[model samples]
Target: MAHTVTDRKKLLNRVKRIKGQSIALENTLENEPDCMAVLQQVAAIKGAVNGLMKEVLEGHLREHLGAEDLSKDQRLEEVEQVISILKSYLK
Candidate 1:
């Protein structure tokens, strides 16, 4: 929750931008229906989503993986979990 509070505006902004891009893509599809334009919009939306993923992942790393009081084994477990998530996400 601390990370969410600290990055509230940032996260909101990213979501808002993604929303805007989605709407724009929808409008373009309805109005122009150009393949290249649609491709560009899709790419932009994917990039925005990836960026948001990165920010959240970093926050998780800072808040959980970087915790100072966790035992070494616990930290390693958390790291492995994070890695598993990343692998699944990238696929």
Candidate 2:
């Protein structure tokens, strides 16, 4: 995950936006907003989080799985780890 250090700023910005969106959602709830507005805010937050997950997952795949220096066992371990996380995420 150290590879993420290279894109830490960009990742932090995304996280900041997500936090803002969450606050907006909370405000909408507090104000007794329309259902459609609440749903839209929820969707935006989900999409933002999914985008972040995709970026990190891609980096992990390219840097860890695609490395030529990994042994067979190491490669299998990486694949298994990815699979386990993906399963949890998908659920």
Q: Which candidate is the best by TM-score?
A: 2
- Candidate 1 Cα outliers beyond 4 Å, as residue runs: none
Q: Write the per-residue lDDT of candidate 2 for residues 23-90, one digit (tens) a residue.
A: 99999999979999999999999999999999999999999999999999999999999999999999
Judge candidate 2 against the unseen true structure and give its global Cα lDDT, from 0 to 1: 0.96
Number of clashes recorded per candidate? 0, 0
TM values, all candidates: 0.86, 0.97
* Ten contiguous residues minimizing lDDT sum, candidate 2: 1-10
The pairs that clash in candidate 1 are none
Quote the lDDT for 1 in model 2.
Answer: 76
Q: Model 1 over residues 42-70: C-alpha lDDT tens digits?
A: 99999999999999999989998888999
Assess candidate 1 and give its lDDT: 0.94
